[model samples]
Target: MSTPVRSSPLALTVLALLHYRPLHPYGVQRLIKEWGKEQVVNVGQRASLYRTIDRLSAAGLIAVRQTERGSQYPERTVYELTAAGRDTARAWVREMLAVPKREFPEFPAALSNLLLLPREEMVEVLGERAEALDRELAGLDASLRAEGERGLPRVTMLEAEYLRAVTAAEAAWVRSVVDDLRTGRLTWTEEALRAFGDAGT
Candidate 1:
């Protein structure tokens, strides 16, 4: 089989937006921000957005519908999704939702090196993180409630739901670990540490 047209998250995002209608890059950027996709799509710089659009065009996923020009401002190129782009967008969404990619999240990386610090220090730091997760979960809950009041169905807000669920799960696990540490249910004695490996380099 021929190689698949690999799409970056930004490229797919642009394709998905263009699937709605032909729009200039500025419109794409605006809709991304307005739709709260900024959390997932990192279009921090306009150059990045332009670059993704260029890539999508080169990949035959998007095409320039027209360029609007006026003496009042610079010319703007309007883009729309091609048939291939529409199919790609639908396929990308399905793959992303169904496949749990191996993401290199910092929490797991930090957990792997957690023994570098004293158990007490680790507990203290994790307690702080737990607090932060609580605040984040509360904010998400409020946002979900507000969106529901505005008639946004849960299906449309599944991303937020996933985030909330993940955060809640992490918080619960952290609390359990904290309780175990405090009650001495989970710990390593000095002898056990030395037996397993050196406590110091």
Candidate 2:
């Protein structure tokens, strides 16, 4: 069998961010924070972000410029994407659009690993995630509307609207899942476990 292609979402996100312009590690971090404002991932786990940049540079998708030392006792490595990197970013975006959405891994993993936690705790976690998604969707919708009213270039406007739609869909899905959990429509019982096992095999 052919090996499955393993790629990091962080790397993909980094490439998409750089498609607009070249950026250093600091710049990427700033852009990610800006994009993820009012969403998850602001809990000071930026190591994954930096590691993705390093991995992309090692893969030749991005190149590190000369290191610049700050006034403090540290230095920073600036990076810029190559032409191939830009193409890769565009291609990844298109591929993502072409794929169908399915249940993500993390949610089930959380449920399965929550053996000791009460069911109410799991429901609360889902509620929190749903709320976060709603905020992100609102932000995306506002941004899209603002950009659309500005009459920007068609390509740019299209991308903004597309992202807004994607975010809205995710938000809707999250809300539905959370509602199911809260209303007893869904449960992580043995039957559910069996169903998952059968579906997997």
Candidate 3:
């Protein structure tokens, strides 16, 4: 009995993109950018993307088909997900949907450090963060809703809907934290503060 290999997030993302259609690396980068227009992925991280693609290829999840483009840049390697890759992508999607999400640390860390800050200053900082999150959530929600209204393909609309849900959940969590801070419901003791600092060091 062999243990199954887990896919990296980037690998899964690449596979998902390729599952939609075959594309060169540049096309993949462009599609990702278009999908996340408001919050662009730095496609400058080509090395990292290609490395994940290589890993996926080795795993038989994707295949490279080469096309010679006359002179300038040799043959371009366009990637397409294999049958295995499609299955893997579907499995990844199911796994992601099934798993309970863990809380991300950045928000908790900021909250923990707030006790060391002046009350007014802490409130101001948290307020700013909350506002930013709200704005982002609003943008994501609008985009998803608009995409939905336009009757985009099922997978594309589903992806946008998933993003919107996640963003909304995060925004709600942020609002709750801000409310706690505003209402003095949350606090940190000195010992806990010391422990946090020690753990960081």
Write one digit per residue (lDDT tens) for candidate 2, span 30-115.
Answer: 87666543132332567877767767776678777568887974687777777877777777767767986575767667766765
| Candidate-wise lDDT, in order | 0.85, 0.68, 0.74
Write down the TM-score of every candidate. 0.86, 0.54, 0.72
Error of 2 at 42 (Å): 8.5
Clashing pairs in 1: none
RMSD of each: 3.2, 6.8, 4.7
Best by lDDT: 1
Model 3, 1-201: lDDT tens digits are 222447656667788888878998877888877676324233567898777777787888888776648576766788888898899999987887799667576777776556678767777876787688788778877887776788777676665566667767776786787787789997767898789789998
Q: lDDT score, residue 42, model 2?
A: 38
Q: Which residue pairs clash in candidate 2? A: none
lDDT of 1 at 121: 91
Error of 2 at 139 (Å): 5.6
Better by lDDT, candidate 2 or 1: 1
> Mind giving the per-residue lDDT tens digits that candidate 1 earns over 97-140?
79878889899999988889888998899999999999999988
User: CA lDDT of 158 in candidate 2?
Assistant: 62
Task: Give me the runs in candidate 1 sitting further than 4 Å from their true place.
Answer: 1-5, 70-73, 197-201
